[model samples]
Target: MCLFTETRIKFRLFEGCAAESGTDGEVVLGVEAGTYQVFALPDHGSAYGAQWVGLTGGTGSQDLARNVVVAAGEQKDIHKIFMDRKGTVTGVVTGADGAPVTGGTVAAVTPVIGDAGRGRVAIDTQGRYTIDFLGPYAWPLSFQTSTHAFQWSGAAHRRQSATLVPVTAGQTTTFDQQLALGTLVKVTATGSPSGRYAVAYNNSNGDVAGFIWVQQAGGQAIFRVMGGQQVKLQFAGGEPGQGWYGGTDFDSAKTVSIPATGEKVVVYPYS
Candidate 1:
């Protein structure tokens, strides 16, 4: 068997606002030698690795929790920076009636803070989905379907309660979720300001769904979600007004619901 695959690995070295790319797993730069953040992206469907600058050649633990220092005329051997094979995560999204949720989207979100190692896959007609390039460990995942509301791996509306799925390298970890459709509410908001307004569903703790609606001209910002669900309206790019429903902080944004079929909320942002 071949020892290495043909997948291309990319390396990104970051030093504050400056960045450099190395396709051969090692990068060289002509700048001041200081500490830098090391980020690795591989095409073999693996999670992106982020750590401190630690380039070693011997069979010892590479120190990645600190910065890397490069000196003049010193050649750093980063050939050991290789991407490992990605693990697999497979699962099914079902409804409260024990029926399969077809055409749903399953996302394997890593708890790594940034958008690294997060993978999304579409549920097949049989409500089955497989996400690759994952680490061999528990992954906090979420699902969204047309007939069901957003639910985490723990069957809860909150993402913090989502259970971590244990994935295996070169193997598949099977998991499933049962969801229920919540009350659908029509949401609309209008405000006056030089900034844009964004709307999303919040459960008094964290965001539940990843959907958002943005309105920039103080016009209609429309969407639908669970009724009476705590949603947040975020304002950006402008200051708030001094009138009613106007403030300089996040509390100035309006939280509304579809109490009626065609009702809308008029918020004053820059009045």
Candidate 2:
């Protein structure tokens, strides 16, 4: 009997004020390559869009393949895909007790000549680890934890049998992030702004989440209230003017929560 592994990620390619395409990524099934459907879903946020296809030419035995897409966010359910990958990797550093090692930093040394992407992922508590990595063939990788250091200065190979595989065209590889162990401050927000619109929850750092904008259509705002036990966060503010606007008050704004773990919040005000 033959065995294989598969993984997936929710990826999307956004267009300006238009329908966006979403992907299910690559799906790895242990079947002799012949032909399969690579599903690529493009959502108008109102209806179904299109589908993509890929061909796997397997001559039997363990092999690798590559698929290509014209657009982004399209999931490919195919019989064959990347038999080889050109990118970096991510992993966790644990103690002898099988515990996650915290405060670790992984570094990338792969040069563009070798086709290398910036490989970096923060290990969360519970020894969780992940990496935003890439490697065309095999690339050297270096890692450092709070107390220990490790190196896989070898070729970073892409898994052939992954459910979520990268396309030859637009690729974004996600390595499962697992850290040895440490205090994690996962932040979440709603109405966080990006571009000219206000998107909630711009939790980049523990400091600022993100920003928003007000148009002539209507004024918008966010709200956040405070509590005693492990303060839950929320945002509230006002945009009375038209065109573009912002805020400059704590009352126009509210207090937020500090997380013991990751958090989620949403608050906005309008005129």
Candidate with the greatest TM-score versus the true structure: 1
Q: Tell me the TM-score of model 2.
A: 0.23
Q: Predicted candidate 2: what Cα RMSD to the true structure?
A: 17.3
Q: What is the Cα-based lDDT of residue 137 in candidate 2?
A: 28
Q: Per-residue lDDT of 129-209 in model 2, one digit per residue for the tens?
A: 543323232222334344321222221111121123232212434443222221222222233332234322212111112
List TM-scores for all candidates, in order.
0.53, 0.23
lDDT of 1 at 177: 77
| Superposed model 1: Cα runs more than 4 Å off | 1-21, 24-84, 110-118, 190-198, 201-230, 234-271
Please report the TM-score between candidate 1 and the true structure: 0.53
